[model samples]
Target: QLLDIARKYPDFPIVLETVRECLQDVYDVPALTELMRRVAQRRLRVVEVETATPSPFAASLLFGYVGAFMYEGDSPLAERRAAALALDTVLLSELLGRVELRELLDPAVIASTSAQLQHLTEERAARDAEAVADLLRMLGPLTEAEIAARATTDAIGGWLEGLRAAKRALPVTYAGQTWWAAVEDIGLLRDGVGAPVPVGVPAAFTESVDDPLGDLIGRYARTHGPFTTTEMAARFGLGLRVTADVLGRMAVDGRLVRGEFIDDLPGDQWCDAEVLRILRRRSLAALRAQVEPVSTAAYGRFLSSWQHVGSSDSTGIDGLAAVIGQLAGVLIPASALESLVLGQRVRDYQPSMLDELLASGEVMWSGAGQIGGSDGWVALHLAETAPLTLPAPAEIEFTDTHRAIMETLGHGGAYFFRQLTEQASESELKTALWELIWAGWITGDTFAPVRAMLSGPRRSGAPAHRQRQRPPRLSRYSVARPHSRAADPMVSGRWSALPAAEPDSTVRAHFQAELLLNRHGVLTKGAAAAEGVPGGFATLYKVLSAFEDAGRCQRGYFVESLGGAQFAAASTVDRLRSYLDGVDPQRPEYHAVVLAATDPANPYGAALAWPDRAGDADTHRPGRKAGALVALVDGRLVWFLERGGKTLLSFTSDAETQRAAAAALADLVSAGRLPSLLVERINGVAVLDPGVDAERAAVQEALTGAGFARTPRGLRLR
Candidate 1:
């Protein structure tokens, strides 16, 4: 029967061996036969039900999946071994026959036990106590009269009573007669996983305890996680207060920690200091071991879909807030944020959605850094949780101008743009204001300034409420130089210094690291580093490594060739490996789309470097700039458009890839993902030239194939 089961798992030795050993070694064939007989006789009613998740009763089974969840020390096994001797006559006879066993002794251990024995009873005339103990070990369940007759002692009863008092022996009723057995046989009568018997107690702990009771409890705590007073009391036949008092003393001695160590089992619990450390390490290691590695390309695609970019639109304020929250610390150009970034993630995305959030104090925008033609790229964070990502005051290097603005807001409170610019030029005030925003010290209460910045310089008398047409063609120099003025501020919302989240940098680093894991399904040091987190990736690394130790995050080298440490949420690691699998072959091809260069979904220029550009290295490599864009097919970069939107860089010069890239861009415009894109130039030349470079002509053909219309100077998508 066992052979048949083994055959079913021929390639899995562990499973086969475990099953065989469990039935044969752990439980005898007789036990199995009895269980089967009961089923045949209908004595047992078998109940079975399927569940989508494990039941609470499966807690013990979870230990099989994670061995560290349960700590098994020497005591449980040692007690079981002692019990086996009492249960078998042959083992008892073997011990009696071995005179050599008595010779194997540690004097220090014996002396220690003797010292504790003094506390149980007063000293008396010495008797052959060793001989009496040996007799109990070899042939216990001996009555007082019978023991006295064999050892020739008249006072055997008094001696036996002392031994029982010291817990060196226990009384047993055998054949309706009272007899004494050594405490080593206690395992045969133990309740749960076995408790501390004489064999398992070491000499080291004997000195501190007046008796064996403390040793027993200490051994149990060493081998288990946080347990309740009731649990310990029930196991050892003691009252709750007695158990608590003992544990309290142990805690006072710094031997055990008293607190809620287990999450679900709340209330005061006690655990050994060393045991907790091991528990954390083992739990994390087990979980970390469950996830497999994936390629860098797969990781990139995972982020694209994970963040919901270039996919179906998620509608409503909840969806909008979720997208903004995911991109909490990401900085992109003010122009691309609404027209490109939001449009990619939210359905029918409008400026009003963001304005509503800003107005209600649900969301606020902060300056991330200067990039593209954007005076500076901006990021939106949930207003309530913004303090968590904001830099500490000491981390920010403020100029006199920055300090001045901060001082005013710190004392006077949030001010509107007009009020803030009352004493200084709008441009000058903005320079210091945006600097503070990027430093994470200030936020805007309204999205109007961002709307104005994306709309280009304000028209000569256009009202602040007036909506403009098509936001002027972004300049060739929309490498939009600052013009000796401050970068744009999130002007409309009232401005004030951001409050600090936690004064401790380490705590904030941990939260930020956790956020990164959730933001990107998988996080690498490179991704966190690119965010310019305070103290950089190194600071977050310490927190991530600790999380791995605690089993909150799994650390691994998941993405191929993207070197250095990588950490991912346990579930996402699985999703990344099996991304969008089993889709229909007949459906229209998906997974190709255009993304903002600064979009968090685009790992390039951030988590992973932009694919190498062979000859145009000096033509300004692609970056996470506002006006720049890139096309990806199944998460691999295909084509890149420079910030100026004039020069185009093809990662792969192949026709199919170029066409796929163009088709994705055209669909974006057709689906209103982006309003429109007119390509005026390619690789520093006019988008089209009659009889121009044949190579350039192929790009045009790919674009035309993707529904692009040819114009006098370039291609335009409708």
Candidate 2:
């Protein structure tokens, strides 16, 4: 039996519960193990999944599908990239065993690199430092390997070595690896994907007891509020045992308040003191209202204590010079750069380090003696401080998409992004807009719904009502050219629509799914249809199926318009029977169109007849007899009539029971027991079989006397 099942589901992961059930009669663990081995050899691989919750493996599965894994890199960029690809759990024990891809190691990035390039230019003594500065300025921070990949000159290694020897660059370490950047651009070496810029911890922070775990919990509770140990472990990658221990210790320390799990989270949870106070006056009313935890403030606090400890090798003046260079000619508050440059507080980010540059007249400082805070110590390079030159607007190559965008602006109005979505393909519109910006024709930030989605809510302390308003314009590049003329003489600034990139059905489906999920938080076939996309319902289903596989959402059924017909399983007919049996007929949420068998010879038979569906009687039978089924799931229904006389059972039960029920239903239909006849245990009636012959005689006699004509296949309708 195990072998047969394995053969049948070769591509899919085999679950342990299935194996246990199949071999329940076996008493020995060894016997079960051997059977599993044989089944696996037959190409049916079993995956054991361990979980603290039902969907614990889902995150890992999603991570694998996206070609990423946890802790793939120690740096923020690498970790953020990994997390963006995570899932959860199971028949979890079974899933835990079968999942071979569940690990934090990243294969994709590893596979992309062959061998690390060996450095050739030994010791900084032999190379030219000036040459290194030119390369560093153009490419930003780079690893030694990356430097080699981009450099055109041989002994590029020697040049990098020489620059480090001359103290022209700063090498910052992250995730156990070092990256080189010019002194002013050390922050650029740090990835911004994780955590906000580190700042000085307030004096208040020093008063609190400082256990890293305790601090993490306190911050979690404050920002996220009332989280289970499992959630904390998952979020921090601290392991469940460690998280639970820390939570327990923190509770004992009186830094955390323990409480019962809220929502569906398991185990007792801990809440921040501040969060507990807020919860006393407020409650989350629904699952959808539950916000995912954010630890931005906590992370900022953690980094604050460790800021600016490293220095560039050049004279102290060069380190100061590097900071100014990173500012890119923009004025930055002195206090802000204090900790950033020297790992010192705002009051201590001294001007003494700049004395040499001041004496040499290479750097200029404004607002001297203003005291070091928000408005103090503004500095600029003498060359950069000079008035900037404006370049001539030269004619450039324009794609049709570029022309369309210019034409839209040619209307001489600032059109919102939504207004432009209809005019050009999204991808092309974005490309054109940015190209125009780079060309000095316009400026603005592009709207990116996907990127915005990653940051669940705004963090800038905006009001709720304000946050609900459309996203702010990123940058306003939509302003017309100097004279409102296209840089190209052939192009006129007129709103002439042009053909855009061909729509990719796959991409469209994914986008539609995202839009629907973002807008509604739930998915139903009918809702997707109404929302509409490139390939309509067919594309929507494919995308949803893919999401289900990746553990993004759970799949269920929605039966159409049958009030209160929502069921979790897809065996629509069986679900219908189950729902109707327990449902109260008088309930406002219940609606049913029951079609009872009619006795044609009886006067009441003609009156009880169901109307034919909207077509000729020969081709279309009434819905009751036409095998129409409605699927119900979470209060939504999708109704459609079966075609080709085939009933695709959306089973709402276990695999075995579903199969049995389907076979029985088929047998009943083939034996003429259920073309249209249905038995209902209504309030006042007893349904005695009344024997098989009696039922057949009644049906035949009724059919003959009723005006309904028998078709050539010996089936009667109408």
* Deviating ranges (above 4 Å) for candidate 1: 1-67, 70-292, 311-313, 369-374, 392-408, 420-441, 461-493, 580-590, 671-675, 683-686, 689-695
All candidates' TM-scores? 0.52, 0.18
Q: What is the lDDT of candidate 1?
A: 0.64
Query: Which structure among the candidates has the greatest lDDT?
Result: 1
Candidate 2 lDDT, 1-718, residue by residue in tens: 5555456546656567755565665566566656656656676556777766544466777667564433233222222323432322113224653222113223322121111111222332113557457545544445777666544545676677777676566566543456676654433222221212223323332232335455445544554545678777755446678778888887666577665524445676666655443333222211111122112222112112222122223235655565444332232234323322332222233545554554454554332112211122232333343122112223569888777777776666455443444567655775565455434344222112211322233354577777556557789765475543212211112222211222455664575565454332334443344333446656777777676555554443222221221112122222222222222423323221111111011111111123222323333332322123322221112111232222222213223223332333333345333343232211112223334343233433333343224444332332
- Error at 235, model 1, angstroms: 61
lDDT of 1 by residue, 384-484 (tens): 77777654543467666676787678785688655664566666777677667656677776777666665566444667678456557576655555444
Root-mean-square deviation per candidate = 30.9, 38.8
Go through the candidates in order and give the clash count of each. Answer: 3, 48
**lDDT per model vs. reference:** 0.64, 0.39
